[model samples]
Target: MPTSIRRRLAPLLLATATIVLAASACSSEPADDGGEQSSPSPSAEPTDEPTTDATDATDAAESGGVCATGDLSFTVTEKSQAGGYYLITASAEPGVTCTLEGRTVEAGFGSGVSGDVKPSEQAEGEPITMTGSIKAYAGVNPHSGPQEGGVQFEEIIVSAHEGDMDPVSLKLPGTAEVDQPIGTNWHTDAAKAVPFSS
Candidate 1:
């Protein structure tokens, strides 16, 4: 070999080795040669849990719901005569809107009286809405039959349309008899509503 040829080949080989070393240093992958390697951090999508919109709660309130006992105020006053029957007025509290479905109300006489007064048979009727400044009432028959023992009730426990609520106790004007009493569906007109039937 000539000396000039050896010098030219040596420079070419050095340049190739430099290029190879630069590429190896710039590699973005982990080395598999038993050398320490950096690992990429785990990444995941961001979450938006534990947050709710205010409109959802408002929308639920606007939708019709069963009347809760806590939202009602009852009174025997404003009684409208429906022929020989009577209506017990029940007004809703402010900022409340609810419905009365099926047998909206049930009345039982006395404090501990469970089986004393019986609920009347009623046909399913359209739900009655009770809103702010609006009232609903149930029909009642003080005596639908003979007064066997002249049994009088001190107070009447009125249950609202809500099934999970406790019955509200309404004190009568005085101890009076309610024999085989019946009731009607809640309606806006107390005068025209008739007694409930099977």
Candidate 2:
């Protein structure tokens, strides 16, 4: 072949070899799937641990039961008197019930309303004593079974109003029970409101 012809053929051969090499390289590379990468598998759930009856008991006591510990107090004040009947005022504890000697009484200040006490139908102006308590349970009818335990007060006086005597000034003695430490102000116009721990 002539020198010019040889040169032209050489350049063409080089170009074809380069194209073949590029094609081969492209075919050898892996294809992308366009899917998201998977994340690591989740860990196993925690196993149940063994617990004792004492541990359960402790939990119940600490969770606002009668066995739980706390302080509750109340002050009684007389509101008014009509036809020898005296209206009284008392306090209410949230999430608890108040009772006199386990007797469920009404809450608030008034005569014949909730948390007020009256003498028996045949009783005269006798000094009244009431033992009460508070509970988290929803109490049944006062005429039904005994009050459940949670918060309680015992032997607090519910005195009738005397002439010229201030009911709020009266101090009564009773037991105040709570499931937890409570700083609630309860007011009643009865003499001697005392609290005992159980």
Candidate 3:
């Protein structure tokens, strides 16, 4: 063969080999079926929900009526001249409130001065002090004065608010009562009613 023809044939052969190699490489490549690349599955995110406030939780636990059956410390500061009237100063839990009912007087005394005392407005905070007297009477009417023995603080209900308890009779001193789902009450032991200077 002629030297010039050999040169031309060599160039053609090189071009054909390059094309073959490229086709083979493309065929060997893996096919993607439009699928996403394999990756670690993302962890699920937590759901969002409103959480209870610490203050609200504490209030709920301590807001119920007084506990039934417990010892409560009470102090009688003043007693009426008629032996029936009494003035008392009592201390409750730091956040607890206290009040006294069933006392007799002309009117406008203690929390009940506004006729009927509601539960929400009883007593608030520690050391709730009330000045009033009890009267034992025959008729069920509260307006009437006590008849002979005088009506006891028949029911003393304390809660985060007033009028929250079942209204149990204040009988035993130092004994606490759970009249509602939460909270407790304390009764005093002092007998002689002393003068409350404050």
RMSD of each: 7.0, 17.9, 13.5
12 Cα displacement, candidate 3 (Å): 23
Model 2, residue 7: distance off in Å is 1.4
Sort every candidate by TM-score, greatest first.
Answer: 1, 3, 2
Ten consecutive residues with minimal summed lDDT in candidate 3? Answer: 134-143
- Give the winner by TM-score: 1 or 3: 1
Query: Better model by TM-score, 2 or 3?
Result: 3
The local distance difference test score of each candidate is 0.63, 0.31, 0.32
lDDT of 1 by residue, 102-192 (tens): 4645665664443244455445666767777776767665556644644577666777753546778777666556666666666667653
Ranked by lDDT, the better of candidates 1 and 2 is: 1
Give per-residue CA lDDT, model 2, range 19-96, as digits (tens). 999988776653322222233333343446535776787765454322111122334322222211112233333443
Q: For model 2, what is the C-alpha lDDT against the true structure?
A: 0.31
Show model 1 residue runs off by greater than 4 Å: 1-54, 61-63, 78-86, 102-104, 111-121, 147-149, 194-198
Q: Which ten residues in a row have the lowest lDDT in candidate 1?
A: 34-43
Per-model TM values vs. the true structure: 0.59, 0.21, 0.24
